[model samples]
Target: MRRKILKVLALAPFALLFTSCEKKISHEHREVHWDRDMCERCKMVVSERNHAAQVINKETGEAYMFDDIGCVILWFKEENITWKDTASIWITDVKTSKWIDARTAHYDTVHQTPMAYGFSANEKKESIVKDSEILNFEEMSKRVLQRGR
Candidate 1:
C-alpha cells in the first residue's frame, strides 16, 4: 500500500503539468494603454484610440499591435507575414472605441492617422469622406502594400 501511494504521488506532478498545458489555442484582443503600449511597426506610442489595429498569428497566438491600420499593413508587407484565414485582425471603430473585425470594417483613406497613413476604420459600410473611397481589408492592405513597393 505504501508503494502504491508513492507511485501515485510521483505521477501527480506530471498529471498537473499535462492538464496545465492544455491552454486554449486562440487569440484575444489585448487592451491597449494609450501612451504606454508602443506600436510594433513604427515603435511609436499607441496614442490613437480609433485608428488602433492589432494582428494575431493563428498558430503562435502572438499579437502585434499598431497605432494605425496603415502601420499594420506596412508591417505585414515589410515582414512578408502570411495573412492566414485563421489569424485574427482587429481594428477600432472610428465612431466607437470598440474592436471590430478588420476584414469587415469600412476603411476611409482621408482621416488622419498617427503614422500619417491617412486611414481610419468605421463600422458603417458607407464612406464618411466624400471624395475618399471606402475599402475593405483586402483593398486597404493592397493599397498600402503597393505604396510600400
Candidate 2:
C-alpha cells in the first residue's frame, strides 16, 4: 500500500506538469488596444481604428497585428510564410470599423495609410475612392511589394 501511494505521488507532479505545459491553441482575432498595441511591422502604435490589420497562423495559433494594411502586406512577404488556405487574414473596414476577411476585401490605393502605402480595404468595390482602382488581395499585395522595391 505504501509503495502504491509513493508511485501515485510521483506521477502527480508529471501529470500536473503535462497539463501546465499544454499550449492553449487560439486562432481567433484578439481585440486590439489602440495606442497601446504596437504594430508588428512598423512598431507604430495601432491608433488608427480603421487601418488595423492582423495575420493569424492557423497552425500555430499565433497572431501578428499591424497598424495598416500596407504594413501587413510588407510583413507577409518579408516573413516568407506560406499563404495557405488555413491562414486567417483580417483587415478593418474603413467605413464600418469592422473586421473583414482580407482575401475577399477590395483595396484602394488613394487612402492615406500609416506606412504611406496609401492602401485601404473596403467591403464593396464601389466604396473605393475615385482615381484608385479596386484591387483584390493578390493585386494589392503585388502593388505593395512593387512600391517597397
Compared with the true structure, all predictions reach lDDT values of 0.82, 0.84
Off by over 4 Å in 2: 1-26, 83-85
Off by over 4 Å in 1: 1-17, 83-85, 126-132
Candidate 2: tens digits of C-alpha lDDT, residues 1-149: 99999999999999999999988877667788889999988889998888889889987888888988878877867877786457888999988879999889998877788878877889898888787778899998888888883
Candidate number achieving the greatest TM-score relative to the actual structure: 1
Task: Report how far residue 37 has shifted in candidate 2, in Å.
Answer: 0.7
Highest-scoring model, lDDT: 2
Model 1, 55-113: lDDT tens digits are: 88978878888888888877876787776456798999886878998888888877777
Give all TM-scores, in the order shown: 0.80, 0.77
Clashes of each: 0, 0
Worst 10 residues of 1 by lDDT: 77-86
